[model samples]
Target: MLDALAARAAGPGRITVFEPSPHLWRGRPYGPDLESVLVNAPPAIMSIRHGDLGHYAAWLGGRAAEHLDPLLGEPLVPRALYGEYLEHTAETALAALREAGWEVRVVRSRVTGATGAGTRMVLGTEDGQRHEADHVVLCVGGGTPPDLYGLDGAPGFAGDPYPLRRTLDRIPSGSDVGVIGSGLTAVDVVVSLAARGHTGRISLLSRSGMLPHVWQRPVERQPRFVTTDRVAALHRERGTVALDDLVGLLRDEIDSAGEDFAAFTAELLAAETDDPVRRLRAQLDAVDDHRIGRRFLQLTAHTVGPYAWRLLPAADRARLRRRLRTATGVASPMVPVNASILMRLFDSGQLDAVAGVRAIEAVNGRFHISGDQGRRTTAVLVNAVNPAPQSIPRGAAQLVDALAADGTAALHPDGGLASTDPRLHVIGDLAAGGSFITSSIPAVAFQSARAAAAVTAASDSGRALSG
Candidate 1:
């Protein structure tokens, strides 16, 4: 996102980034991290430009040639390596802009609040400093994890789950650790802990108790069904796809699989009678190509997830949420290596699963977690649930909250905020009416480019009108 913004805002007025880190391009995902931390996808699909899918590959070839031996193939490189790529990308863009005579400053401070309006906007920082700008883009990345069980600031609870390498260190070695969710973040926590040689009982607790599915090596194939044009057609015809139509489209796709649609979907949604850990482990061992089915369904969702979300009536959205919300946790499966480590831990009796963890109460420097099935107490409890986009303020940046409070920004009916003040634009997960899969590097790049173009056009128009 910073790369896109820097390119657009170059050759003119100052473009000041309010990030405390000089290497703002790295963001949080690509920040300095252990080599054990690998990217979910390969180098091919990671470039900022859609045409240059191999840009990152080329970068790797020069900087870290060993990691790029397979050249055109997909290899999950280290996360920090990606960080270095981003820093290099940003530096190159900055140098070009400087040569073209534009001032750029990567300010090192937290933006406390954004006040005022329109072209007169003032972004206040923690040190009682303010920076004025004509347009503010709210690409502040992911929000804090929602306090699912109100465990914020508790002794044995961790609300913010990033830098798992450090946060997991607080847990005493050999102490039982209860992880609250079983999504990607939870998998990372478990994997990081095991890598650190923390020999302790790790309990993965959740309502469904389902971990992410294993990822397979990519096969070159375009989306067969659920094309974007189909979604556009629906919008063209009725302007909105009701909950029933959405379900019917999925059912149609399932029918195309040559199986009993009803039975197939039922089996898909049915709970595993066997232990989930054992099931995932067996999957890892057998390594079937069954991910094709999941990939199709996922691609279908991505095609319509964002637009369909906005078109739904408020009541329908709530119904859809109630039915499909929990399914999201297991939607995007984890990378294979991480899944393997988790399976190994579970097999070794060091890791466990607890179902229906509804609440956590801290006591005696420990956490007592209770749920529908049963209860358990653990020495340390880590909240592994990923941040929810719907929950505003709880996980949102303070600037977003402040703007929201004063109605400078308005929450989109779909999810994120829209600001009438200063034409504040929100994108990525923070943008309500966008795909839930924006966490992907490609998705972020695409959206960032679009946002930068929009910002440039808006700035140009403002200048023209003023002149």
Candidate 2:
């Protein structure tokens, strides 16, 4: 979106981006030294620009082709290299903005709040400086997670297990590491430890004991019976569809697929494959023709998720929250290589998946966990959970909280912060509930274009009025 902002703002006032880190545009996911961590999506699907799905690949082809790894005939590049790619893209955008005589400034302080009326906005910084801008874009992805389990400040309790390559290093060699969560973040933690040749038993603790499904590069699919257009039509006819209605629709689609859908789901959840990664990839290959159909349905869900989510009665939304892990497990699967690394660890008796994580307590100079399998002691407890939709506070940051406090910012009933004043635009993960999937690169790019267009139009209108 920053890229789009840079490209579209031709009649601009100064463009200032507040990034407290040296890693501009790269953000948290693409931070430095995370070379071993693999991206969940293939290079084919990860482009910061719309209609140019191969943008990242093309960039890599020119500079870092060697970083590409061929798995299942798709390129899975290192996360750090992707970070470098983003930095380069940002540099290009900045250069273009400068060439067009627009001042582009990167603020190196933490932005806490943005408050003002109409076009005049005051952005508050942590250092007591109130920087002003004509427009403010809240690209604050995910705010830092509070210690959900009250394990903060405890010995060997590592909060924010990000830049995993570095954080996991603090664990002693051969120490047992208990990671709370089964998503990509947890996978990265285990993969990072394994890649660093750390000899330790890594336990993945989750509610369902279900790992993210292994991903295959999607084949072209057509939505035969289930399409977004149809879902939108249903929404029009009913004015709103309940959660049960949507589920029934999905069940019908799966039923229409007959044996193929049944087999795929069966294989996906079955414990038959000791090597879960290989089994999943093989299952996907077996259903190659039908794989895209499932993907198309998933895409439809992404399209309908926001509407369905918002239309859902409060009770149904609660149900959705309860089933979120299952929804996430199927909807956002991991790439094969990361799963393969996990499978290898599992096979080596170095990793185990534990269920029923009921509690965590500091005990005897170590961390003790009581869960589905009873109690276990570990030398390190790492929180690898990603911040979910409900995690963002009204005042997630100082600026956001202040906006909420003064009634300048309104919380979207679904998710995200909206400024009562038009100049403030919030997007990304923070804009959850506004869209079903805002975390992916493609989703972010799509959103960035829309937001950029609106901001640019406003800038042009301002210029015209002044002229």
Candidate 3:
């Protein structure tokens, strides 16, 4: 939001930011963590500056090569290092806003409640202070990872395994570890453990045991058929976008690239039910695949995803929801570097992934897990389950509840704040009426731009009315 305002020179007003974390720009995911915890996406997609794809890469300059992950063929830098880029971008935006006659104040406090105050909105903070604003943009990050196993106070169990720096050390290097969930977060725990020279067996337990596909070396080809403009044109003509219509566009894109769409999608679906080790090995080998299917899906999943999602009929939306796990795995793939790490661990007989996790009990000083593969006990357990997209965080629950109770704001049936109220804006994962998938950085950047424009335009209109 600050970046958009600064870019537009929309100032001459005061802007107050409420942030309780010590790390200003880096939220929970990017805060100080082990170097092994990398930014999941490449620089091409991680930019916060909307429309400027190279913004992050430009900031990296010569430092890019130093943090390159060779297997991914892109600079998959550490999350902490990426946090530095966020901090730099934020400071630059603040400076520009100040120079443009904007008074920016940073309050190191968490907002607890929000209510309507005439034309303005009142925000109550945890510090027992209230402030009024013409518009409020809720940027409270994503929801907390749920304790699926009810292991909050259990010994040797990490309910939330973020900033692995704190959680990893407490785990004894020699203790056998069991990680819940086979997604990116679980991969982070495994890789960070290896980096810390931990010499214990590690097992990933999940319902599907499906791991994220490895990202292929990016190509220069742009989508010819699945572009947002094409989607908009379709919606104008048909009034709704069906699942078959989307598949048709994808088919055209793949065929135009001279690849067999049927074969590509077949392999993709098969990977979901394929053996873990074999699938990971195949993905590692296909890092340089020339096929355009995955790349096309990746590009459009964010850009055309939300827009198409809104226009999709209820039946089509339900169809997509049925395969949510597959969609998530394909859309958010792991870096080749981590895929290789998992393979090595598998080869060395130190790592394994099991599906059908039915029960997890904290036994006497150990974790006993029962799943499709029967039972296994580990000395330590880590919950790496990805949080549901746009679910409200525990800390901000009070504020959101207050708004919903007062009819000041409401949540979408799909999760996230509804767009019914103009006085209250939302960005990041909390924003409603977006793709069911969690908001990516690029998606968040787009939301921020829209929110900034709305706020500034309203301010301009108010001033004009007074004149």
Error of 1 at 425 (Å): 1.2
Clashing pairs in 3: none
Worst 10 residues of 2 by lDDT: 458-467
Model 2 TM-score, 2 decimals? 0.87
Ranked by TM-score, top first:
3, 2, 1
Clashing pairs in 2: 112-398, 112-399, 113-399, 395-401
TM-score of 3: 0.97
Alpha-carbon local distance difference test for all models = 0.67, 0.69, 0.86
What TM-score does each of the candidates earn?
0.85, 0.87, 0.97
Candidate 2 or 1, higher TM-score: 2
Judging by TM-score, tell me the better candidate of 1 and 3: 3
Q: Which portions of model 3 show Cα errors greater than 4 Å? A: 461-467
Worst lDDT 10-window in candidate 1 = 458-467
Candidate 1's residue-wise lDDT over 126-167, tens digit each? 889877877677667775667777778888788776667668
Query: Per-residue lDDT tens digits of candidate 3, residues 360-439?
Result: 99989999999789999998999999888878888789888988887878888888777556777878778776666878
